[model samples]
Structure formats: C-alpha cells, structure tokens
Target chain A: MILVAALPQQDILRLLSAQSHPAIYAQASNFSVADSEAILSISHESSFWKRELHFQQLTQAARNAGSYEIGWDGYDAPKPSDDSINQGIALLNKIKEAGLSPSSVLPSADGGIGISFRGQNGRRALLEISNDGSASYAIYGKGHPRLVGEFSPTAANLAVVFNRLSENL
Target chain B: MKPTVQHLSKAPIVEAIIAFALEKPLTDSDAVFEQFYALIQSDYPSRNPVKMAQLTVSDQGSSGETQIVGARFASADGKRVCLVDQSNFICSRLAPYETWESLKSEFERLWKIYSPLCNSRIARVGVRYINKIFLPEGEDMSLTVRTRPEIAEGLPQSMFNFLVRLGVKIPDPQGVLMITEAQLPTERPGFVTAVLDHDLQFRINPESTDVWSLLDKARELKNDYFFASLSEDVIKEYL
Candidate 1:
C-alpha cells in the first residue's frame, strides 16, 4: 500500500461524506472470503479488467518518478484539504499511456476519481487519487473472514478507510 | 389400382399484389411472404421441395426477392416425400411461395398438426414465425414441432450455460443451489423452491453470468431469506 501526505484531510472527508463508495460496504458485508479465495485459486477465473488494472499500476510506477505510500483508514487523518479528483485523473492518464481504461471511477460526482486495483492474495486496493498532484495515494484493504465489517467503506472512519486500504498489499 | 377420388376441389388462391406506390402504408406483404414461404417449404405438399439460398434486396427500401434452390426426396411404404430446406434468418422474409397445388397440400397437412396443439393435452404452443417446413404430397403426413432451449447452439455462452444449469446437477459437487436473479422470487417461487430443494446446486451470478464466481461468495452463505413464489409485488419490490 502506498501512503503519503499528498492528499489533504478535507478531500478524504468529502469523499466519506458524499458516500463516494456507495456499493462497496453492502457488497463487502455480503461477500464471503471463501469465494474470494476460490477465485484466486484459478488464475483464469479472475477478471481481465482486474489483472489489467494491476499490471498497469505496477508497470507505470516503474516508469514514473513518485514514491508509493500505504495509508490505513484507522491510522491516518483526512488530507489537510482533499483534492483527489485531479490526482486520480493524472494517475489515469499515466496508466492510459501504459494501456489501461478503467471501466468506472468512484467519487464520480466529486473531482476525486477512485481507482480500484485487484491485489495479490485476493486482496484489493482502492486508489483515491486527489485531482491534484499535491495529494495522491492508495488505500490497501483487509477484512474479516466473511469480509462483513472488515473492508466496509461506510463503516470506516476516514482515516481507517484510507489506512486499512493501504494495508492491502 | 382405383384412381384416387379427388374429394377436395381446387381452392383457387385469391391473389392480390398490393404495391405501395406513394403512400407509406404498413401492408401484410412481409406477413404474406412469410406465410407463403411456410406453406410451400414446410406445410404444403409438393412434387419437389426447394430451399431458400438468399434474398435479393431491391433498390426500393422495403422491397426484396427470395432465392430458393436445394431439394431432397425420401420414400416410405410405396409413397414418395419431397423435403425442402429453410433457414430462420431475417433475410428469408423476401421470398413468396406461390405454387397453388403444393401450397394447398402443405396447408392441409399443417392444419392437421396445428389443430391438435389447441387441445387440452397440449397446453399452449405459441405460433412462432417458422421460415421453413417440409411438406410431402399425397399420403403419410406428419407435423413436427421444434423448440430451442437456452443451451442450444448459437446462444450466448453466458446465457446458455446459466439457463442449461438450472434445475440440473452442476458438474461439480455442491450444496443446494438456486441459480437465478434475486428479483421477483415470488414470480418464480416454484423455480426457486425446486432449486433450493435440489441436492446439487450452483448459481449463475446475477450481475454477470460469465463471472460465475462473482456472486458465489454471497449466495452460498446461510441466511433465512424468504422463498416466495414470483408475483407483481416481488417485481416491484426488487425494482
């Protein structure tokens, strides 16, 4: 997980308030770890989009000059002033050059673009890149066996959501 | 051999060529074309059966011509049957089969089979727009019904596999499984209960059937969810 002070507290707080990740919590609540594990067992069973998105992130980071930081929702404070939308666009542009087209980005109404990437070990990372370069990072994820309360975006305090996501890697 | 007594008189097929000149009117040309083709290729008795190759579209926006060619013959019990082939493509709409003797014979044969479907034992069989039918002239007539299931060839794999797996044992061993969209459980209560009652089961994900595992995690968990028959209320509730 890439954690950094690039993002401001206001931006993260705004996303949380707006319910930027509306469907994630309920889905997580209903999801079973056993299914995720089973999916991870067969490489071919995973989505091409998931694999492609991860490949672009890893490969682009190699080409670009930026430090990757891991932020946990429980541990970190909201960015001083949230500006994830522009940051997300920049990340997306960088990855597009590397050949990636995200099906959809979250915080769509706001400037923030939530970039989701499937991680190793069946974990996932939601990259809430601020619209500006000033604050852009990733949120690693973790959850309980059933994934019930573990990775719910709604349940997490702003910092916990960000920090917990950073722990995905 | 006694000359077969002709009991039926020649029903001169009253024909009319309603051409749409200036006015844009919705005519039964397409319907007439379809019925005529069915009468010739499938339901009508003919000395020779012909299959449609392609339909030629005229410069006019709505005008086209159908091409018919292939033919085959079969013999049984001192009687001969000629079979014509037809495809269920949209292009088959252009051709009109107009040979009266063959058309009448095929119509008579088809009516015999079609009449039975309306009976109590048959329940309800819909009148599908079939592009082809095989009608043999003279004696020994048979009308066959064709229905394609979801798993039939040419169907999308996502749809095919999902539908085919319903009410059947999954190739892999598993617990009771209900494979369908969660909406309107009351609408399809019988289907849902049958699946729940089944010994082996796997559900096709509602979001995307291709991603078979997407909902697998959500579905297999134990929950006291209600299993009611499908109804309008269930439809409204889900929507």
Candidate 2:
C-alpha cells in the first residue's frame, strides 16, 4: 500500500523564499498547491534551468565559491582564490550596473570565473575573468563572424563588452 | 544629399538634451560644484538648484532609492541651461528651437567649463532630439501619410494609437541608435501629435581624450537616424 501526505502552507512559503534562483521564485509564485510536499519536490529541480539564476544570486554564488571544489565535470578543478572571487564579485556588480544579466556563472579550470550569456536571438557570448584581473570575451551569432578579443578590466573595456551584450538583450 | 529646412513657422522640436557620463564618480562633488558655479555664474547668474533621487527596482518587485544632489544653472531667459550631477552632465534647450549647430556649440561651451573640474575620463556620450509633429486638420492625416510608408504598413487599420521603438546598430557596431515613435491624440478633435524621439549613444575607451570627436559622431548618427526614419515630405513640412 502506498501512502500520500501534504505539507503545510507555511513550510511551502518558507522553502520558496529560501530559493536563490530568480526563476524558482517566479515559478513558485504560480504554484497552486496548498501543500508543502509538492513545493519541496519542485524545489529540488529549481537549479536545473540555467536561466533561473539572477545577477545578485550569481554574485553570492561567486563569493561563496571562493574555495569551490567541484569541477565543471565533477572532476578536480582549480578552486577560485580569494582575490579571484573578489574580482568576480566586482565584475558581476559591474555587469548589473551596465543593466545586464548573465545566463550562467561557472568557475573556470584556471582558478578564474566565467560568465556566459545566451541571447534570445540565438547569439552567444562569454566573458572570462582571470585571477590576475585580465578579461577576455567572445561573441558569435548566426550570420556574423565570431568576434573575440582580450581587454583590461577598465570601465571602458567593460563598456565594450556590455554594449555588445546589450544588443543581444 | 544634405538635409535642409526652409524655416517652418513653428519648429517641431519639443526638447533637445545632450548628456555625458564620466568614467568615475567625483570624490568631492561640492568642490566641483563650486567651480562650475563660478564658470556659469557670469551668464547664468540666476540659479534654481535641484536634487534627484536615483532609484533601482529589482525584478522581484523591490525598490531601492538613493538621493543624488545636483544643481541647475540657467540663462536669464531660462531657455538655456546646464544641469550638473555627481557624475552626469546635461545641457538642455527648450522651445523656440535653436538650430542644431547652435545647441551643439552651447553644450560644448558648457562642457569645456565643467570637464576641467572632474578628474575622470569620458565613458559615454549621448544626444537626444524629441519632436512633436502635428497633423493637418480635416485631411487624410494618417501616420501612414506622414511617416515612411514602410514603417506604417505593418500596423492594422483598426489601431488608433501605437508606440514603436527600435534600436539600430551603427556602421562600426560601436553604438546603438534608438528611434521611438508614438501616435497621441491632441486636444483638437481632428488633430494628433506624432511624437518622434531619437537618441544616439556610444561608449568609448576610458583613456579616450577626444570628447568632441565622439560628440560629433553622435550628432551625425542622430541626423542619419532622423532622416532615415521619416519621409522627405515630413522633414520638409516640419523640420
């Protein structure tokens, strides 16, 4: 015999509030269930959607990953250093200041951080920030040739990347 | 072909604004303010100081606001003025439209005075032109007739009012030029005002030293977008 039980509404609300992913909160807003069990079940899959991550959450994740151990493929990876994590946080703040959001934030193999953006119009771009404070970016679209370049972490250089990303946004 | 206007009795320009962003926020805005006051006080002796609150609203429906202190320096006629904020600079010219060259020259003049007080580089420069085109009364004054036919063909006949916005990339892909057009009803029964606003903007290297050249490029892009978006007849009638 199988048994079924429902969780309390208060617990569901708590679980939803604790979610750092923006899309999870957005999805939970429409959750019609009056039970906690259902909410908990769906919360497990919140991070599955890459686009659910918000800019603020990305910054927090980058900061928390200062000593991240997991690699991109679950293998050994270079953990982010304190300086690299700080630079990553600053880069995320600059991205928000430029009115942009990243699609994903991942720790790079070289103890750096990678911010990726997937445009609605099939354009894809990435910005890699090294621990030494150097930045490089690449942009590619369907009909255009790939654009790749390296730049310093100055406001001007960031503006160039921001401007291009804004077009896709 | 060079675009020229044969003097419309009533110019269509509603407002003209030129703004620039600094590479960094001024550490001591008060000192810069005093220097700006000393420079503009000669011509714009009358002043009406102003304060602004910058607000940022999160996607999750949260609000954050911060106070931004600034002042407005105006000419005796109140037609010309410069607004200086912590990191942003703006010069505006209202009705009785001055020619583009005159407005540009005035803004450049003010920029010269204000730039010296700041120890930051130029990050971005922008120029905006807002125009209100009034349609003639008792005629087939449809937007289709006033604007380029290509732009109007996409709309349905049942649509009474609409707003269309587009961002076009410049030749160098270094900037974005935005064009916004709206059809609004006027107090007069048969008259409607077509609001056309254009903004040309570009970001530059922080080490850039030639601010005027960027402004000039912005002006040229603004003109290009203005002419390309409207039909020649519309420009001749009201520009």
Candidate 3:
C-alpha cells in the first residue's frame, strides 16, 4: 500500500523539494503542487494496479537512490504488468476464473479492447475503452451491470478500482 | 519485452532509443511493437482552448456521470496514427460530443482565464467533430452564454469565443468541417507536422484569413513547441 492517499499539491512539492535527487525533482518540479497532490490523491483512492504505483514510486526512488535508472516498483502487492496487452489478458483471465458467465473480449481495429460479459440475471455488461500507459479507464454500463465510471493513473488505485467494478456483482 | 510507450516517452533521454526503435525497415512482431509505440508517443496538436487542469471534476462516490475524451491524429489522406489519452477530469484532446453546445460554456469560462496566458492568435476555434467544426459569428463571441446543456461539444463556449475574439476565423458554408467516426492513424511527428502544415496551408490561401491570423499569434506565443514531441535532433534525423 504505497500510501495511495492524495497529498495536497503544495505538500507534494514540499516533499519533492526536500528530496535529495535533483534530476527527478526538476522533471516534476514544473507541475503545481496542487496538480501533483491531486494526482497522488486520486491514485490512492482508485486502487491503482502495482505497476502504476511503481511508476510513481520509481521517480522518488531514483531521486532517493541518486540514479535515474532505479525503479521503485511496489511489488508488495500483486501488481499486474504495466503492459497494456498483458493487463488486458490478465483482466480477461480474472474474469474467466471468477466463474462469471461467458464473455467476449473483442479487439478493436485500433488496438483497443471491448469486453462483453453477461451477469447471472439477463443483464449485459460492456466495457469499451483505451489506455495511455497510465491508469486511465473510461467505463460505461447499461442494464444492471453494477458499476460505471472512469479510472485514471494515480498511486495505488487498482485495488479500489477492482472492488468498485466487481464487488457489487 | 521491448520498451513500453510510457518508458520511452518520459523526458530525460530515451528519445534517441525511441527514434532508433521506430526507424524504417520494420520487421515482424518486434518491429510492429516499435511502430505502434512510436504512434502512441507521437505529438498531436490540440486546438481546444481548455487545458486539462481547469476541467477536472471530482468523483466522490457520486453517480459519476462524465464523458471520456479520446483523440486520434493522422494525415489528411490518413496515414500515420497517433492516439492520445485524456486526463480524467483534465484536458480533453478529443471532442467529447459532436455538438457545439456541449463545449461552448466551458470553453467560454476557460477562455476568461487562458486568454491572457496565451498570446497566440486564434485559428478556427469551436467544437470540432473529426474535421468538421461548429463556429459562431464574430459578434457571437461576445454575446455567448455558458450553460450546462448548451455545450453539446462538451467544451466551454467562452474558450471558443475567446479565440474568435483573438482573430480565429471559423469555416462557414459548413463543408469545411466534416465529422465522422473514422479513426485516423498517425505517429507523433506526423501529427505535429499535420497541424503545422495545415496552419501554413491556411495562411498561404487567401480564403483562410481568420485561421492565418491565429497561426501567426501561436507562433509568437512564449512556448510554441511546448506541445510538440520532436526536438530539433529528431527532426534532423528524419529529414
């Protein structure tokens, strides 16, 4: 749980300012403290998958480690791969094993995905969206599929996202 | 196993790696991923006046009704493809809706704050659905009102009005702005080139007076290249 809470933008800046690393700080320094903090806050709230958290932590760790190559991936949690294709596969696998009814995972001509699943009732759930190498998802729902909304990259937000999506089902 | 788009696109070196990986003579799956990565990392120009920072709405366990923004840039003939992701509540690179009303109000409010921050002359500004756009007359820029249901484009009208006030000429007679669901594939460099080329083309043609003025203004802005992905080195490499 890489402290997925959203700190105030000012606080994020203040923390970054105190960091020992200069290059990472400089790269991130341009963002207003408010923006940085908000993104972090959202990450914590969203339950980001592990890789997203690692990406966030990698910057701080690089600064802390005094090397740009260092990556702070929080492997503590069962974080999924950051690769979109792999994540898509992982998601499909999870849905399949969860004993949920048969669903179709359609690939878009544009390299995106369309997931169609049927609930115990006659309702249908469709998740059609894309990604940006970050934790961003746009979900729309119809019938009684349970959840509908968007998910964006932050720190530790995937768990929350999974719960929000499947808990009700 | 190769580098992910996020890994390569982040600043502080890796540009050369990206360029190297994406260079021509692409082969097999490895080459295909490289090509795809390049497309994902390409810089596409966004004419929308509303920055992501201003439009973000909070989601606090509410019904969470919001539209997602999506953008795809390509050549006029549709060649290279660049796909850009939208910030959750942040800047929208894609037109959320096909109508002008959706964006008019938000654009208006954002214009109030962003206009001073910009010195660029406005090109044709308004709700753009693919190549098509809905624009208002010169006088409409001032009289425009911001309302919830009015922004069919899901953009603020003020932002559109501000650009028109700054000198952007919206295309009229309607044919110039065509909207469709066709996804255009474009790489980052291709996208930037398209925008620059489109603006320059407009300037050379006398029929593009309004758009010309806006291009001139943008050129004079403090950071013309802020949104561009290719540096001089990258351009030189390709040339």
B143-239: candidate 2 lDDT, tens digit per residue: 2233321324545423334455544556553765555565543323455556677766666788877777777777766666565555655667763
Query: What is the lDDT of every predicted structure here?
Result: 0.28, 0.61, 0.27
**True-vs-predicted CA distance for residue A158, candidate 2, Å:** 55
Of candidates 3 and 1, the better by DockQ: 3
TM-score on B-chain, cand. 1: 0.15
How many residue pairs clash in each candidate at the backbone level? Answer: 60, 1, 56
lDDT of 2 at A91: 78
Residue-level lDDT of model 1, residues B117-137, one tens digit each, is 222121111110111111111
Local accuracy of candidate 1 as per-residue lDDT tens digits, A49-127: 2233344344343223122222323443333113343344445545443333333454422233456655435555554
**Model 3, DockQ value?**
0.02
Docking class of 2: incorrect
What fraction of native interface contacts is shared by candidate 2?
0.00
DockQ-based CAPRI category assigned to the predicted complex of candidate 1: incorrect
Q: Highest DockQ among the candidates is held by which one?
A: 3
**Can you tell me the DockQ of model 2?**
0.01
TM-score of chain B of each: 0.15, 0.77, 0.21
Best by lDDT: 2
Supply DockQ values for each candidate. 0.01, 0.01, 0.02
